[model samples]
Target: GAGVSQSPSNKVTEKGKDVELRCDPISGHTALYWYRQSLGQGLEFLIYFQGNSAPDKSGLPSDRFSAERTGGSVSTLTIQRTQQEDSAVYLCASSLAPGGNEKLFFGSGTQLSVL
Candidate 1:
């Protein structure tokens, strides 16, 4: 896909299990972001990565969640010991620049379900 690509479009796991979600952004994009959106809720920022610099993970719900961007292109989000409440649609987006407003290209998203 020329736009952002996400793998395992849907995931189902038992409580306490671990899952890894992958996102491959468009080539040459410098900024990438992860967001979580539960049913009927708005997008919740999870993390932001800009180039080789440090990532902002303040939006992570808990210490069990972590993400890393490799080569400023592909980013992976890891959730350890998943809970039922963690079920949501995980969205990945990329922008040419970092800011509140930019032309962001979003992926189809990974829907996670914890049973």
Candidate 2:
């Protein structure tokens, strides 16, 4: 992909449904990040993967939320037993380096709605 790519731009589901969001980063970017934006939460950092190892999983709200990166390129975020509170725009971003402030290329995001 020429840039960060997120799939299923919009997802609507009933409460208790599970959802998976995908992100394919730029070919050479080694730092991938997951964030969620909602009117109530603002922008929250969910997780970050450097290469295939995740050094930062602290941002995830609970055990129900998890993410993983494979082959140092693509990443997936899974939300189990969706709640209306979990509805938000899930965003993915990548940077050339492993730092919070590094310039990033962001995907459009997946808007997940739980009713």
lDDT of 2 by residue, 1-115 (tens): 7889999899999999999999999999999999999987788999999999999998999999999999999999999999999989999999999875799899999999999
Off by over 4 Å in 2: none
lDDT of 1 by residue, 14-76 (tens): 999999999999898899999998878899999999985646888999999999888988999
In candidate 1, clashing pairs total 0
RMSD of each: 1.2, 1.0
In model 1, which regions exceed 4 Å deviation?
A: none
Question: Which one wins on TM-score?
Answer: 2
How many clashing residue pairs appear in each of the predictions shown?
A: 0, 0
